[model samples]
Target: MRSVLDRGLALYRQGEDLPAEELAKCTALAVQLAERGERIAPLLHAWDVGCSVAVAACWVSARPGEQSELVSLTQWSSVGVKEITAAISLAYVHAQKQAGLDTSRRVLADLMLNGSATDELAAAAHHSPAKEYVAVAGRVVGENVPSAATVARASAALTTGDLGLSCQAGRHLCILAPIRSHRSTEELSGHMVETLKRVGITFAAPAGAVIAPRSELAMAVQQASRIESLAGIAGLDGKTVESSQVISELAISRDGEYRRQLISLIDPIVEAPELLKTLRTLYLMDLDRSRTARRLNVARRTLTYRLERIEQLTGINPVRTRGILAFVLALAARDLDLSSSVPEGV
Candidate 1:
């Protein structure tokens, strides 16, 4: 079994079309071995199936015009079983749509029932054919179907790859992407901490949160302790008190202070109070002055003047980092207090 897996991996590394086919064959053998009551590990079986599916997905994605043939081959081969079947059906539907097929409820139903109709399959089906599917899936899966405002917030976080913010916006349904840069983990973590604040996700980096390739579970616990110590110095409160925290109370407190300062700095420049109401709209629209002005039913020149006055009062450039930070803080603050004073318009 080990020899078969090694051979499969070697073939995959060859990176040729023939090698992909060979790998698929080996994966089938591995699956057969597992089903025959061999000592094959479930993880090994999973890997084999995943590799076969990935190779097939690559083939289809590379030659979209050949998707039908690929799908047929995958289905008949039973390479990745239900998963490959679903992929094939999804690819075919997408290809058909691109070719101007109607691709409505009928097509969706066909795809859903084509393979094992797991929850994901059903959810995908309902998304296309039925409005009620989303609500039902939301209830069953405990996924938060965020409001339009929350969607907007989540979209912004996704655009920037701000995982903590995305998770917060999506109500913990999102996972932060693993850091891939050459920067130290601590630095990357610090940046994540700051970004989470901007997006209003409260989390702590207890030792356990600082997982590394070589770090042991004990080391992780120690790291959590270090984070807790740091949090105490920062003067923050947390959802719970533990030796380890993913986010410290001090970080939350600092975020609150930063937000307050932002509002305090901006509140004096409101030559036109209505601009405050437009802040969220403007930020969502990516600070396009002309676009914001149009949305607010005001002239571009008037909008520019107000923005300039706001900059003068806040001493933060509307187009720069400080200004963007202030804008976000102000928006969050608005949600907390509608009757609060509008920042002075620049």
Candidate 2:
């Protein structure tokens, strides 16, 4: 049998020419997937773009000799045609649920990336009135990322009545959902994590999420992405990590320039494995010089010399609160493995 997306759109006629039954299949499948905890955003998004192209093709195909306008815009490739047809199938599905709801371009673009939601997205992005909003960003370990619409649909199932939206956004699976007034972010976050796990999600790292006001959904997303990374590094693999759980890392991470400065302080030490180990161990042991020396199995004088050398090179003494904070933050940043990808944004 032809896929739900391609079963129709054949023998192109005109925009909205696709049959109601064929289009309805896409909608039915979307709802079904959402109910069963599958991702649907990417699938619907594919449908959106695909259908838009298909209609454009149908419009041009009907024009025939008057195709000059259509020719410039379309590449006329087989893949391009297939994509547009899929989109038509997707749009028809939406038309089924919301009648004339277009989802608009703004919603589609936002869903295609891992970021926050802006006020503009509310119109077509399924905004609902709720006391809390949680934005999720997750990626499967390999190429087997679930279809977009399938993931989105899965997210919606969590709403259990409240307004929710979920979808595959680029490499991440995302959700924008509301919280009941009685539900705490921790409860919601933990529940979502467990739910995703129960559904057998094959994420490389567990999902990351942030719950906040609608106005900060975008920043929440960025924070969630980082929390996911930090959790992975902290050995909390395959568990949902929320922003509230990592306050210090979140604070240290916010300043792009300050993070760089902290990292710079450790660069000179990095070249010397012994010195790196010394300072890292010192900080890791909570400034216990005796314990650090004993763990390294070095004499007191040797430990003293290494500390002096670290101070000489970085000019930051580990004994001082400010200096130790900087040292620990730098290593924590390294431990989180964000030394490179962090600067690029979520």
Candidate 3:
């Protein structure tokens, strides 16, 4: 298997028409080996099929008349050749700007609805070196197109820390990301983009769009804050959990006096304009001083000096393990508090 992967990769790196053909052959062979009751079959097959499809699609697109040959090549390549071949056919139609988009979309839709077994096969093929590549297929053809209300429901489900709902939301979002990107980013940001499209959200890569596990509570707080008609919105409101109150309680419960002490210690430094900017960047960059320095376009030593000054002014070491935790929580608190003050649904 290792030899098979090495051969395929080597062919890929060689970079020529012949190499592409040879790589396709090697990938097909890798897929065969993956299916021979190998434990890592899923991963190997994923890479094998992805590379083969990608290369063959490119080749066929460049030489549109060789459609039959492309079909034949894919048919002989693997057991699930029909689906792969269909993908190639669609890719060709898409490239040629032919009337096959609707046809291809319908085929894909059917495959997603009735092809769970194929998805599992693809998942198996996505097992190792191929895992990442196979996921591309799984994300594309396996995902269901959820509605906008489904997205909102999924978001709401996430509020309860229900892992299943979170997963459902994540999967739906992953699909939505790519569809949105197709109009915006490019043809190939892969499965991650697809997932986002399904969920109907666009996220810039550098924006760190991944929802942290711990952030679910924060999401719930944000959602609750959006109920304008809730009595909590009026000053004489009925009793309900204020989002800031929730955050403050959670923060205090997690750290007690240590949390408050840390906030007090850091507040004065944050009041200093220059120091606040540095700390803000540091937190945003997850305390990667080098990245913070890069974002600030300051020398690393200067960043260090700024951090040191923060610690000096506040009597708290930013680098200390406890200090870092406290700082992040404090920042979360500040964000929650500020968000709570905004009118609901804004």
Clash numbers, per candidate: 27, 26, 31
Please, what is the whole-model Cα lDDT of each candidate in the order they appear?
A: 0.41, 0.60, 0.40
lDDT against true structure, model 2:
0.60
Compared to the true structure, candidate 3 yields what TM-score? Answer: 0.30
Q: How far is 291's C-alpha from truth in model 2 (Å)?
A: 7.1
Highest-scoring model, TM-score: 2
How do the residues 1-346 of candidate 1 rate in per-residue lDDT, one tens digit apiece? 2343345434434632333454445445534443342322233346446757655655756564766655555453454344443443444334444454322222332222222223453343233122111000000022334333333343354345423212211122221223455654445545544443476543432211344222132233234434443433433353223333324232323365664655565576545466565555567668887788888888888777766766776677766887786676554543433432111211
State how far residue 132 of model 2 sits from its true place (Å). 3.1
Tens-digit lDDT string for candidate 3 (1-346): 2344344434434542223454355445434432332222244336456657665654556565766655644444444344333333333224322332212222222222222113333222221111111011111124344333443443343222211112222222321121211221223223333344455543221111211122132243233323211212222122222334344434443454654554565677766777777877887787898899999999999999998998887777877998777766665544434344333232
| Per-model TM values vs. the true structure | 0.26, 0.53, 0.30
- Residue 339 of model 2 has an lDDT of 48
lDDT by residue for model 2 over 1-346, one digit each (tens)?
Answer: 1354344444232343446676555556655553444444456456556646665655656655756635533443244444433444344334434543333332433443322233334434445545467777777655446575446445545444543565554556666656866776656656665565565555677678787776566567767777766666544544567766666676666666766777787888888999888887787677898999999999989999999998999988977999887887787766654544442464
Model 3 residue 322 CA deviation in Å: 2.4
CA displacement after TM-score superposition, residue 18 of candidate 1 (Å): 67
